[model samples]
Target: MKYSPLLSELISALTCLPGVGNKSAQRMAFSLLERNRDGALKLSAVLHNAMEHIRHCERCRTFTEEPVCEICRHPQRNESGLLCIVESPQDVLAIEQTSSYQGMYFVLMGHLSPIDGVGPADIGLDELEARLKKEPVEEVILATNPTVEGEATAHYISQLCDSMNISATRIAHGVPVGGELEYIDGNTLTHAFSGRRKL
Candidate 1:
């Protein structure tokens, strides 16, 4: 059976979301039309408003409606003199959930992938360098993912920090708090051993 033109368009649009394929999108389109038209309208309105208003934070590159994100504007975070560099805005949200870190953040938006043509300049290293030179940041915590590209990005940022006479430290990559040693991968096991502290 052929879907109506508007129904087909709605299904296609829903498939653009991550993990939502054609089948899932079709199901969603059907469910919205048959069961929850009001909810769908609300979703459409919110999505349109967000698309129109949301933009990257000027300082951290995180999604926000304001010029700078709330974290960047917080005076106490600035006083901490710590800058945590992360790969994405989601990473910043994850770190904030812990409530353990009291510092500002810089979102890279992505890792360096030479094969993909990503470079230091592409990931906002120039802006970071300028911030380092002007701000009183005493330490930079590289909280990028543990992928190969993430490692390279962290190393590059470390060297940049060194050139500016600032300290840069990579977040430890190792086993989780409750993870069993037997289930851990070799690379993660190695990192856990290498990052071990005297306890």
Candidate 2:
């Protein structure tokens, strides 16, 4: 069955989202038209508003609406030199959800994926170094993902820290707290074993 031009356009636009294919986009488009036109209009309005106003924070690179992010502006967060370097704004949200880290964050927005032509300069490593030099940062936590690109990025940052004499630490990657040894991957099990602490 052939869809109208407007319906085809809606489906095509929806397919731009991650994990949303042609079928999913068609379903979404039809659902919006059949059941929730008002909700769809509201969503469109919000998306437009956010697209117009939201931008990366100057200091940390997280998404924000103002000149600087709230976390960068907040006076209560740790100012004594602890910084967590992460891959994206989503990582910032995950860490903030923990409520355990009191320090600020530095979002790389992406890792070092050379095959994709992304390098240190592409991910704002120079800006990070500038921040380290200008600030009183005593330590930096490498909170990049556990993937190959993430490891490369972390190592690169660690080397930079070594030259500057600043302490750099990688976030421990291991099995989850309640994970069964048999269910976990060999790499994760090995990491957990190696990172084991004295009980």
Candidate 3:
């Protein structure tokens, strides 16, 4: 028997999530319908609420319910001579897991991609520069992913820092080539931070 239009649409919508194919979407839809109607409703409600309530923090660009995220609001986090640069909020979480970095962070929200027309402006580089000038950051760590694009983005930022006369560095070689910071273990991340070198 064919499923109703609404059910088919719901299953199709579920495929928007990464790695969820049609089969998995269908299974998820069936599971939600069969044994957990209330759970499914709660899921939908949470999704809607998060979409409406969560916004990028003005300082770090991490998603938060308030104007500034918890990290930016923290009193004890090292505000002076801070580190600044990241690809995403997940990267921030990964670094936080290590508990080794005490400096403030600035999320890029994206990397520089010339082909994709994603330039420095697209990722809030202007805001980053402004922050660097306004804040007392002695070092800026470029913690982008270990990919070609990530390297290019880091290089560009490093050059920008040279012009601004701010000390800049990149995370050390403990991070595997082509691996993302979010995927690396906390211990490795801690080592990388400790061994960071000048750009």
Candidate 4:
């Protein structure tokens, strides 16, 4: 019932991943050791290389090995003059997957959570403000999540945009399309009602 020290260490390290608990980590470690040592070695090498080389893009703060991310380096992104603000690099990937947006992004890395001692500066708001001042942004799209912290962060950035006479818009949050009203939460229902568009 006892794993070797290295196996135990591997399980513990795997547990550091989000949603990977002790049992899941143990399963992964055992699978790698028992059936795929070569694959495990490749994974370790790739992960180590990524950790060593990948860093935040200077312009948008998204992950990249080069100085700037591919999206940020795209000249048309600057020409679009629309900057979509998001709370994490994952949000950028989600938006890109849609292929509907062609503008640039500013990844906050996190939302403002004062209770947890997270502030604007901690989430790269200062860098965002500087970008707004220096760049020729026509509008800022606040694509933060619908959580309380996300709303607070959006409001703060909106106010900052107002001070600089820049247009700021928050992405609408409401009941999902095809979702029945009866099953929707009151807050989502209210948002859907208020955010209704003309037919």
Candidate 5:
């Protein structure tokens, strides 16, 4: 009638994933056990390995096995004085999928949310400032989502850039109001990046 403690624990752990309720977890556990044990084992192993080995890139803050992520390491990528700031690594992927942006990226890791106690420093603002000073970026593009928090974050960064005499810009209107960068289509993202306006 009841699963073993180990099996139950596995199901419970699976439920920790976003949108995975008890029913979904139960379904997944049963499917993993019944259909593909080897695949499940491989998945677990990969998860463990990634968790252990992956780290934030020193320059961009994207997760990678190396000290710097592939994007940061790529010699062909436009290291030619362009930086795109985003909210997360997923946003990096979304923009990359467009294949339009050749510039380097800076991941904020999170947006500024005072109510939730998330501040600029909490999301690596100091590092961003330091990087702007050290790196020769001609343009800094704010590619944060079109949400309230995202706008606020972008505004804060833009002001900082102004104070520091850095050329800062915000992506144009392709991204819907209150929409997330992760959910926007590649074409839209490309358009937004291409049509960026000075902040």
Candidate 6:
């Protein structure tokens, strides 16, 4: 079916979003036009505003309207000389949801993918090293994803921390709380076994 120029343009723009295909874009377009026009308008306004105003926080690389993000500015979030390094703002959000971490953070935004031309500088490692030198950082937490690139990034960061004499630790990855042994993969099982602790 041929869409009007405006509809066709909307569908094309929507496909720019990750995982949004032509069909999904069409469904979204129709849903907004037929059932949620007001929501669509509000979303457009917010998207435009965010695109214009959102920037990476100088302190942690998280998206923020100000120079420093709320997490970096919160008085209760005093660093205590510990910093958690993650691959993206989403990882920071996931860790924050656990209410477990109590220190500061460094968002890499991307993993180390040499084949893709992403390197230490591309992911803000130099900046992180500078911060570590300036601050009395006692520990560096490697919280990057459990992918090959994530592992490489974590290893590089760990080496940097070692050279600086700061202890580096990695977040444990293993079977989920409700996961069963039968369904577990070999890599996860190995990690779970290697990271096991005594009762």
Compare the candidates by lDDT and give the number of the best one.
4
Estimate candidate 6's alpha-carbon lDDT, on a 0 to 1 scale.
Answer: 0.91
Q: What TM-score should be assigned to candidate 4?
A: 0.95
- State the lDDT of candidate 4 residue by residue for 12-35, as single tens digits: 999989999999999999899899
In model 6, which runs have C-alpha deviations exceeding 4 angstroms? Answer: none
Query: Least lDDT summed over 10 consecutive residues: which range in candidate 4?
Result: 172-181
- lDDT per residue as tens, model 2, 8-111: 99999999899999999999998999999999999999999999999999999899999899899877565757999999999999999998998989999999
What TM-score goes with each of the models?
Answer: 0.96, 0.94, 0.84, 0.95, 0.85, 0.93
How do the residues 1-199 of candidate 5 rate in per-residue lDDT, one tens digit apiece? 7799999999999998999999999999999999999999999999999999999999888888999888888776656688999999999999999899998999999999999999999989999999988988889999999888999999999999998899999987678889999999998899789877889
Clashing pairs in 6: none
Worst 10 residues of 1 by lDDT: 56-65
Computed on alpha carbons, the lDDT of every model, listed in order, comes to 0.93, 0.93, 0.88, 0.95, 0.91, 0.91
Estimate the overall C-alpha local distance difference test score of candidate 1.
0.93
lDDT of 6 at 51: 99
The lowest-lDDT stretch of 10 consecutive residues in candidate 3 is 75-84
Candidate 3 wrongly placed segments (more than 4 Å): 174-199
**For residue 28, what is the lDDT in candidate 2?**
96
Once model 5 is optimally superposed onto the true structure by TM-score, how far is the C-alpha of residue 68 displaced, in angstroms?
0.5
Query: How many steric clashes between backbone atoms does each model show?
Result: 0, 0, 1, 0, 0, 0
- Better candidate number, 5 or 6, judged by TM-score: 6
Model 5, residue 80: C-alpha shift (Å): 1.5
Can you list the residue pairs that collide in candidate 4? none
Cα lDDT of candidate 2 equals: 0.93
**Which regions of candidate 2 are displaced past 4 Å?**
none
